[model samples]
Target: MTVTLKNGVLDPQGKAIEGALGSLGFSGVGHVRQGKVFDLELEGSDKVKTEADLKAMCEKLLANTVIENYTIALD
Candidate 1:
């Protein structure tokens, strides 16, 4: 699962990173937003059920649903 703040949300960390990049002379890098990515090894074979469970996990604990959004991918 990956979690990130929704568009228009204030990202103080992202802003700080952008400033640091500018100070280091990395030009033209615009709007840096930071997020989380998780790699999970699942024991289930059912794709539908696994996705449902992952969504529940994101909603309940992994993400703050009010200001963040999450996406899940299976490999």
Candidate 2:
């Protein structure tokens, strides 16, 4: 699974940090995106099960349908 930021949402915290960095002499910065962290353990240690479980978790609990997006990867 993969994660991404929800489109058209105003990320004020990320934006403020990005704007501040520019004024402090940082250059060539384009987009500063931010998202949430999702952590969980499942019954199986296989990649397919983990991915499936993560997708279900994302749909059920880890992400907010109104504002954020998320993805899953096995460690």
How do the residues 1-75 of candidate 1 rate in per-residue lDDT, one tens digit apiece?
Answer: 999999899999999999999999999999988999988889969999999999999999999989999999988
Each model's lDDT? 0.94, 0.74
Error of 1 at 71 (Å): 1.3
* True lDDT of residue 67, candidate 1: 94
**What's the CA error at residue 67 for candidate 1, in Å?**
1.0
**lDDT minimum window of 10 residues, candidate 1:** 37-46
- Candidate 1 residue spans exceeding 4 A from truth: none
Superposition error at 11 for model 2 (Å) = 0.9
Q: How many backbone clashes does candidate 1 have?
A: 0
**Count of steric clashes across candidates, in order:** 0, 1
In model 1, state the lDDT of residue 31. 95
